[model samples]
Target chain A: MKRYFWLASYPKSGNTWLRLFLESLSHEGATPDINAMAFSGGHAAVRDEFERLLDIESNDLTDEEITRARPRMYELEAQAANAPLLRKVHDAWELTPAGEPLFPIELTLGAIYLVRDPRDVAVSLAHHMRQSLDQAIERMSNPQAMMSMSKRFIPKQLPQRLTSWSGHVESWLEAPVGRLLLKYEDMLSDPEAHFGAAVRFLGIDADRDKIAAAVEAVAFERLRSEEKARGFVETPPGVEGFFRRGIAGGWRESLTPAQVTRIETDHAAVMRSLNYL
Target chain B: MQGDLTLCGWRVRSALALPDLLPWLGGDSPVDIDISFGAIPTPAEPPLYTLPHSTLWADGRFLLHLEQVGKFWVEKGRRIVLEPAEHADESELRTFLLGSVLGVLCHQRGLLPIHASAVRINGRAILIAGNSGVGKSTLAAALGARGHALVADDITAFDTPTAMLLPAFPMRKLSLDVLDRLALPHQGLIANRPGQPKFHVPAADGFAPAPLPPSAIYILHTDRLLKSCAIDRAAPAMAMALLDRMIYRRAVGMKIQPPPALFLGLSKLARIAPVYRLRRAEDPSLHRLDALAEQVEAHAAVTRPLLAGSGTE
Candidate 1:
């Protein structure tokens, strides 16, 4: 049986970058083809997928009803899976309405949770959500933050309930299960060390040279060019670009001190523990 | 089994005298299907398709189990054996009966059912297709509000004989939020199912009982980037692909993996009727909908005569 793992993170964190790195290893090329990444056609919350698997209309289902059937959906995906699958997930590590973990441990082999500097995250999220820096910071600060909740039509994935960033990080960290955390800053500072560590943690035995090539292949410039040449599927309807500037601490130039202070204050403990400070 | 009825171009006999289906009563033609309020007899053959809640095997037999609600056995594309859970509400059983059970039955009979809402335009069928909750029913309701006859809601089946779309239930399912936005009354309507925000609005004002010949298929999409509505026609090749996607529960249908007849049927439909991509504004309202319906009407006025002259049928 093929094992399932989660490429899990809070949105705009290094989730996509990490996936590209993994795809580079899979493709074993000079540069990872941005379009050639092997995930399901999309992330974990696809409505059409749920309905297709369960043979029920997901839109007709209440949010709680979708949540109730979510674990079963994962199981079915595992059953139907032919290869080792790494499904992308943005939802906080949480439980379904039935009190089962939304992403069940029984179905999962492990997860790679990517955490980024909350300060830089504020700047990127502002652009991704099309909100002011202050508004994005406020949204991130709030424990009840969510995406695609105010949608006018059926969202592709089910509504992802992300309690605040602190809660999101802690939920995964606090859970005693197969989870490996990778700081985005670490990947930037030492791509070879961190990326290879992640690959080994996920239990893939690859040549060190090949792993180094995978890291080199997913450079920020190459990803942005690919998004420019062909639009990204995950790009929201009006977002200018999904592959925004992939620099850390660019937040210093963009975020007002007050905005930085707010994120720091909101997530101070997690920052210090994750060594973001 | 009791008195049988015909709706959505299928004859159905059921044990329950469902009030929702009362309006669609009195079809004495040869029984195309049956519904019994009891346990189903074992199929003479082993299950061809094994699933968690349902089992389908041997020439269109399906035993569907709706968790905590009901268990249904759709047999040989001709009979439905229903056993509702003790204390299962009317709303629960009917939701599956009208949606998936009937849809799979149609698929079993080698019919192509599209996930769309439809209305009669210029005395012909104009389909509004989209993913679930893409405002298919809302657009169909808005069109119906403009006095266009509502032909089908949710599942619109194709009749190969006439090369026309067969109308489904004479009701449009609208979310309560939309009903509030439109200021439509909800005094006597029933919620489609328990705990669901949507209600089944009976098509009392403008409902079409008979099947109408094909005219056009409008695939609906909402673009946040687009400031206004844009309707673009799909070329023939693209239209065929779109029709394949428009199949109701397409992934589930793949399990049965209908024969080439399904593709031939859908491709034939695509070749004759024009398919359009209608992208609308992010925030939809009655005014925007009025503009959209007008654009579609104007487009149809030009194309209907062209379609009639083609003589492909």
Candidate 2:
């Protein structure tokens, strides 16, 4: 049987970094080609996988219909998988319209939810989306915010509902499943300790030395250089880069006081719980 | 009212109106397939092959259930029974009927269904094949704009012995953005499903009805990092792999047909058709399509003389 796990997060929440580290860990301390991580399962919202597993064209279905079929898609994927699978997901943990969990609980081994300070996320997301800082801040706080939901063109991936930053955090934290939470700041400050914990949580049987090597292989500087060498595949067509300045608290310099206050105000209670306040 | 139609050379007598197929005009032939409204029984035994939303039983029975759409049961490749939802729209039901259900029927009958959109270039079929959303239909539409007649869209089935291409319905499915990008008129476009950006456009005048012999096949691909357009002729080994990957509803076909049988059909196609990989820089607006279309036409014209005596028939 194949065990499935989710690397869940809001956008730009160190999800890719964790995945990179896991890739290095699994491949015997070798840094993976940044552009070649497609074998690392894949994104949860990839339209091709949905269409392939469901045996129907996804463009013919509404977003609501797509969401309802996602759990089944994952179930079938896990059943057919020959090895353990780790899938990255940005959709907030919630129920479908039919009141079933959006992610199948029975097939999941666990989930690793990576979270970041919304103020800092706003800065990174602004660059990623090529939006003004104010626009990014507004989107971060909007409960109804969705990604890849374009009206004019059919997006490559299915629409993912990323509720308000706080809603996203709270939804994953409170969901009834096996889960581990890691802060981006904490991972940056102590890679060996945090990433080590995640490796052990997934029962990878890696020692501290192996975890340290994996961390060094995917260090922020190496990742940025690799991306700069040969453009990252995950970067959108017009985006300059995907791995920009991996740091915590860049919001202090990047965000105006008003923008910081808006994120804090919008996400105060959840931020307080996660110690982001 | 029952409608008599011919889809991919199969005489179909369907209770549902399949606006995509050509009306059956030939005299006195047995119906190859029958479709109607009926209650589909819930399978009590374990499914032989199962997808997320569909299943194929050991007895050659298939069932597909789409949320908010309906359930479809394809039995022995000869009949299709549908039990639609209370709020199912006619267009939504017909969309799956013509797409997935027909794909199943083709597999059951042991035909090679290539997931491609083809156009007739000088009365010879040139297929642009790829996965869904890879712009096969868009490229076919672009070729149509360049004076080529559309042979088929999405699912291009062929008779294995003669390697003759069967023309699908005279229609194209284009997303609203594609229509706007290509500047094509979208009047009377029927939405494939509510809230979906894709619409089915009637292409009656620009459609080619006759079965054409395969001349060339271009597998469409896009890369954001590509600096310029690249077209590479695929070797025989690579062509076999590409054609196998381009098989429509391949998993269902694999379950229905043995490997040697499938291999024989693909080998025949790979031997006869000249296949190439056509790549362009990814652009959502399809702005690069004009250049790509011109390149294809030029390549086909240059290769036409060589293929004329090749005897694809």
Candidate 3:
């Protein structure tokens, strides 16, 4: 009984959206806030849980320190080893500390790769990060900073972020994992079709009408409204804004003309390939 | 013409022409050495060595291919290639190649090459075996600091005559954390690659040329600390199972082959080796060298008379 299902994606590439969709689809009456459960987003509740699990004073540790601390974190999280453990990870497909491949090419049952137009990702990231479009563009150029920033509160680092995105998606697609590549635009346009495809890939008997309703229930407006009305629970410090403007192409109006041109110039190849340009 | 030499129990073969050695070196040799030998000639360049594989080396002979990229040594195959470059300071290149090549050859010969650290206590070999990052090197260093001589770390080559075991090499590789914990100077840490540090610790005094009659083999586990230092004897079947886990499975390649008969012989040898699963706390202070040495010495004393009587019969 293989129970672990890795929910992997590059940062801010619609992984949270997928999680919310999954949360809604997996349970009908259970209104567990998807934002609170997402590992990537700045949800106060999940941040506290991650910090306690890692036993770190803060998330400001260096990459080397984080790598050393990860094994202990995994051990602590071992109790959550219930069947179909929907694990969220940002690491590239590689062997674990024990020398066993984490997702062996032979046994990878299912994976979902969410890719967004790099332009929109850059745009949305700049607004969410509270940084200028130019600063975000520069951050994306430096891979080390990008990687370090991913562990922190801000998502300003672009190169490391995008590289991770490309690497994670490519690894699963190439591996024997039954991978489904769903674009952010496609999901926003037709959540039911894409979510259903993801469900079928997982070998689940999901009904279309119910899944569509769940998707609607977990829409960006619904989550935003919930965040606004509830005053955002202070579950974890250093991680706030459990829900921001969860809209696609939000970067268009937010980024200046020069900023847009710079991002397009910087990640043009990737954006063009994904048809974002 | 000049090459590094080390004394071992096995016989050494003749050195062939550099050109002729190219194909034998194959992909395992250092890239610089491979190019210098011109084994795989560039489109514009002519081939330097073209001797047939049969004319160069005999089958079953131990050939050492030391590649330049990592200064690695490949042993126990028909062909050997050495790469060029002079970055001999990096310990990982040296250890990785030496272990990988020797591991493949040992597998072919039916001897198991364990990813372990061994030491000589009371003139008997006590092996500390475990998976990578399991503190084998750290434990070995602790034992070494306490006056026990180091045998090998990361890779241990085993040679058995009939059923008695003998030590092959005596060196240990320590990670940065272990080195820091031991308060050892930073001089031994070699930067072979970016962000990866490999520490080389020399054998202790009176430890050279010290091959011990095997007394015990312990598989070390660092995950959970044991209440006390306990030695649990392993059954023949269980010993073989443990040995199989340590065997370098990657050297076998992709093809399916019959299980080696050497495993059966090894299982019998394991029974004689006094196999034990040593579980200890993650204590950096509890150097078990002297205590373990005493235990092996006692076991040897009891087994010696029986071994002699059986030989006489």
Looking at chain B only, the TM-scores across the models are 0.90, 0.94, 0.65
Estimate, for each residue in B1-313, the C-alpha lDDT of model 2 and write its tens digit. 7568877777899888887778888768999889889899777899998776778898668888886889999988898999999999889999988888878888888778888998999778988998777789988988898899998999888767777788888999888878887788877788878767788988889989888888888898777667557889988899889888888888887888776777887777666678899887777767777888898898887654223424354
Model 1, A1-277: lDDT tens digits are 5667888888889988888888788777467657656643347887777777777787555677677788888888888888877788888888886788988887778888999998888889989988999998888877878766643344556778887888889988876578889999999999999999888987787888999888888888888988887766567766889888998899989987887888889999999999887
DockQ scores of all models, one per candidate: 0.26, 0.53, 0.04
Q: lDDT of candidate 2 vs native?
A: 0.85
Instruction: Tell me the docking grade of candidate 3.
Output: incorrect
In model 3, state the lDDT of residue B286: 34
Per-model clash counts, in order, read 2, 0, 16
| Cα error, candidate 3, residue A123 (Å) | 24
Model 3 CA deviation exceeding 4 Å by range: A1-6, A9-89, A92-110, A113-142, A145-199, A204-277, B1-4, B11-79, B85-93, B108-110, B192-195, B204-208, B224-236, B249-258, B278-313
Predict model 1's lDDT versus the native: 0.77
Residue lDDT tens for model 2, A92-157:
999998789988888788999999988889999999999999999889888999999987767778
Runs of candidate 2 exceeding 4 Å displacement: A38-41, B41-47, B303-313
Query: What's the best-to-worst order under lDDT?
Result: 2, 1, 3
Better candidate number, 1 or 2, judged by TM-score: 2
DockQ of 3: 0.04
